[model samples]
Target: MTRILVVGATGLVGREIVRKALRDDRITRLIAPTRRPLEPHPKLHNPLVDFDRLPEDAGWWAVNSVICVLGTTRAKAGSDQAFRKVDYDYPLAVARLAHRHGAMRFALNSSLGAAAAPRLLYSRTKGEIEAAITAVGFSSLTIVRPGLIGGDRNEFRAGEWIAARVLGALGPLLPRRFRISPAPKIADALVEAAIAGASGVHLIEADQLAAD
Candidate 1:
């Protein structure tokens, strides 16, 4: 049985993860901290919290694994600095705290183009977080990088909507790496990685998320 903490429980991919994890027998408990409440589940401990001011010493931090899908677009954040705080800082903070509390597994939801080298602010921030989290020293670390995610989102993203349309029309014509990654698939990968607690660092890329 695994006790797992899921950050970003309200987001698109995060929602999928929570749904699956609650139904998974391997998970004995799920601790999710969100700005708002989630539907009550017997196995879930939902804590309403501000990510900027998380309770560092809370007992809920004592989990076997952590899945961090927290992210926000620059447009939604209203500035690049704000975006970094969400996509980079918050996730890293959660990782460090979880590790400190004896969590041995970590799974991160990243983007397709994330890299440490200079590039788009979004990609750079993702890369930096990946690096920062790695330093947290979880025995099992999994990073999943998916392409344009496809799912019904609670909020509208004009850019992703337009891109999804274009990519949907292309479909199988595009390489697997460029195809739209289903939100549920990404969530499944994160949950499985956390539960399995496989040793060493593993990278699950866009192509791997697709069904054969």
Candidate 2:
């Protein structure tokens, strides 16, 4: 029986991850900590929490695996530091707590251009969080780096919508790596990696995300 923790249960990719995990017979239990409440389920332990102060001693952190889909856009966050707090700080906090509580597997939904020294703050922050989580010592760490995530987001961005539409139209013509990655497919990969509990660090790049 695999017990799982999902940190960003309310976001685009996170929401899909939660729904899929619920229907997955391999997952015996699921813990989702978010600012808002989720729909009630028999297998779910949904806790309303402030990202700044997660409950370290909570029993829900003691799961077989963890999948973090937490992220925020700079425009929505309203500042660079605020964006880092959501994307980097929140996920790292969850990773450390889950690792301390004996969660052996960890999976992250990262961006395509994540790097330690990227010119873009967004990419750099994502890279930094990936490094931070790796330091937490999970037995199995899976990092799924996808291109611009294509989905129906609750929070609308005019620029993102236009880009997605263009990419959707040109998807077949573009190379696999350049094509947009669907949210549901990314969620499936994250869930499977967590449940599989494969040893060592594994990276699923933007191109691999297009494959089964």
Candidate 3:
């Protein structure tokens, strides 16, 4: 049985992944360290933690695999530095801790434009995080890069809300690569890849993730 650690368990896609991971028979234990609490589950071990001050020596980091769905918008973060801290710093912190504790598989919910290139700050941040995570040396690295995510978010983002609606309406008429990706679809792909823990790096793009 595999023991897994999931970061960002409270978010939209993260919640879906957590639910599936908790129910997976292959997963013996699921550790989700969040600021708030997740509902009780027999297989889950929830630890309330501060991202800025994670417990360095916690025994819970000893997992076989890790799934990171941790991210934030620039608007919500209030600044570029704050966004980078959440998107880049936080994920890398979790990856290093998990790697140190013997986790071999690391799966991340990245964005479509993630690449080491001179692009938008958001895209560049994602690229840097991917690069940083690779440096951590996980045997099995999986990055699922979804486009505009379609789901019911707790809070509203004017731009994203409008995009999701437009792309959703376009549906099959829209190109697969640029279509609105359902949150659950991305979650499913991330969970499966993390649990599988296949060797080498696997980059799943939005078009592939959109597949049923």
Candidate 4:
């Protein structure tokens, strides 16, 4: 039986990941942690967590794999430091805990152009987190770099909504790397990667994510 842990369960990508994982027969259990609590499900368990101060309980980390979809925009986070805390610190912390608790695989939802030397703070933060998690020595690491994700979001971000609508209209005319991929497609890819049991880091680009 495969038990999985999903962080950022309330977000757009995270929510779909949980939904898909719950339906997968391979996943015997799904542990979802969020800042705000989520409703109960037969195969899913929700844990309320404080990002700044995660609980000491080791139970949640004792899963087969850990998928991190935790992220926030600069506008929503209010500052670069705040955004880094969510995009970098919190996810890295979860990765460390998951590794220590015996998780073999770690999958993350990163962004396109993530690099440690980038001028963009968001991309740099994500790169740093990826490096940090890699250092933890997980047996398998899957880093998914999805471009402008298209889906109904929990929070109203006018920028994202406009971008999605615009890209939706443009369709195949847009660049493959810049195209808007569906949330459910990305979620499906994550589950497939986990189930495949492929070892080592796999960098899934926007085109590959959209193809999935």
- Give the candidate number with the greatest lDDT: 1
Worst 10 residues of 3 by lDDT: 112-121
Tens digits of lDDT, candidate 3, 8-107: 9999998998888888899999999999999999899999999999999999999999999999999899999999999999999999999999999999
- Itemize residue pairs with steric clashes in candidate 4: none
What ranges in model 4 sit over 4 Å off?
Answer: none
What lDDT score goes with residue 10 in model 1? Answer: 91
Worst 10 residues of 1 by lDDT: 115-124
- Rate residue 167 of model 3 by lDDT: 81
Q: Residue 134 CA error for candidate 1 (Å)? A: 0.8
Give residue 40's lDDT in candidate 4 (0 to 100).
86
TM-score per candidate, chains pooled: 0.97, 0.97, 0.97, 0.94
**Model 2, residue 174: displacement in angstroms?**
0.4
- What shift in Å separates residue 57 of candidate 3 from its native position after superposition? 0.5
Q: lDDT per prediction?
A: 0.92, 0.90, 0.90, 0.85
CA deviation > 4 Å runs, candidate 1:
none
Expressed as tens digits, the lDDT of each residue in 1-212 for candidate 1 is 99999999999999999999999999999999999999999999999998889899999999999999999999899999999999998999899999999999999999898884557898889889888998889999999999999999988888999999998988889889899999999999999999995899999999987533
Which candidate gets the maximum TM-score versus the true structure? 1
**Candidate 3 vs candidate 4: which has greater TM-score?**
3
